[model samples]
Target: MLSYGVSKSSSRVPHIVTFCCNNPHHPTTTHAESHSVVTRRALSLLATATASVFSVPVLVSSSSVRYLEAAAAASTPRFSELPESGGVKALDLRVGDGDYPVNGDQVAIHYYGRLAAKQGWRFDSTYDHKDETGEPIPFIFILGSGKVIAGIETAVRSMKVGGIRRVIIPPSQGYQNMDQEPVPPNFFDRQRLFTTIFNPTRLANGEGSTLGIIIFDIELVSLKHL
Candidate 1:
């Protein structure tokens, strides 16, 4: 006869131990059999051990990780190679030969000035409350008579009447080493001060005040006979 014994610990926390003995009558028996009660006890003990070991803790995933990755990828920089004037990209022009004109020519224009970073306007003739609806005022200036900044005069000399153009004036040709009202002296040292001059004209010995970055949308209103 063959005998199998199984030992177990407590019921709430159970452990099992199995022992087997060979039968004298079955000398060549490679397998052994156990009673139903013992087999069931062994299985119960195994189930208890598995439950204790597998009931620990685990981590789960959320959308935060995916959102962060997407944000980083979107922040990548992009570059372009194109011509730029007065810090403004020129897609087209309306009037003028794209050159500066001489003095004593009647001119009309509309303009606006603001910081390069799109901050609020530093100065704008159109926004003056004195004019109803704040319309653009027309003005005239003589070229190269110390009436306007060197940059503006230079740009005007290249323009013709009834022409519109964009001018990019560096600080060197603009205020240059001087400071004026509204434009503080500190700004003169900042090399990035530029202007866009639209249409402009040369007045007849009409000396104009020197101003920085005068972008004129000039129409040759009329010219004085030489």
Candidate 2:
């Protein structure tokens, strides 16, 4: 019976040792290893996803910037070109030619601004006129100070007092790169995307817009030479 008891104790001791070897600390170490591996993989995947998302907009913006640069280069010649008009006979007034001084000068005139394609008056001081049958509107401007647009300054200088002339101003000369108020968003965007920004007056409100021409029927009221 003593030998049998000793054998039983030896067998029990082996089992206890095996149980200690497989205890919580060993399992906890395995779990920690597994958790670390999973966390690393998840972080890698999140970084990849973030990079993929940001790359698309970056590519799009880059392409847009390139396209705009190319378009601006191509449209360079349009500015120096002469303007054409129908229905309203255009008067020959070349920019930077004749008495139209580029300096600051006070000028008074009757004028109207209209969209050439739409054939509608966009702005006119003619509304105050009690008589509407082919009458001129009254306006005053200080040239080069930006009381008016570049094209208007050019046109006003070409005309003598009481000379009725239809002057066509291309986008390059008029509001080049400047956004005029009351224009549609789509129109403004199209203009801005393609047009060169030019503010002869250097006003803060000047922004680029569509490639339309401005027709000015001008009568020079006065010129204050600077």
Please, what are the lDDT tens digits per residue for candidate 2 over residues 64-181? 4354344434433322223331222345332222354346666666554565534543444342343466554355566656545666666555455545556666666655433432
Give lDDT: candidate 2, residue 41.
Answer: 45
TM-score for each model: 0.35, 0.37
RMSD of 2: 29.7
For residues 1-226, could you state the per-residue lDDT of candidate 1 as single tens digits? 1111344432232222333455455433232233324444433434444221322111112243243234334433222112322332121144444333456653333333333222332443322323465543444555445655554455445545555444544434545442421231234322333332111242122322322333322233333322
Q: List the residue pairs that clash in candidate 2.
A: 108-221, 110-137, 177-207, 177-208, 178-207, 178-208, 179-207
| CA displacement after TM-score superposition, residue 180 of candidate 1 (Å) | 6.7
Candidate 2 at 112: error in angstroms? 2.0
lDDT of 2: 0.43
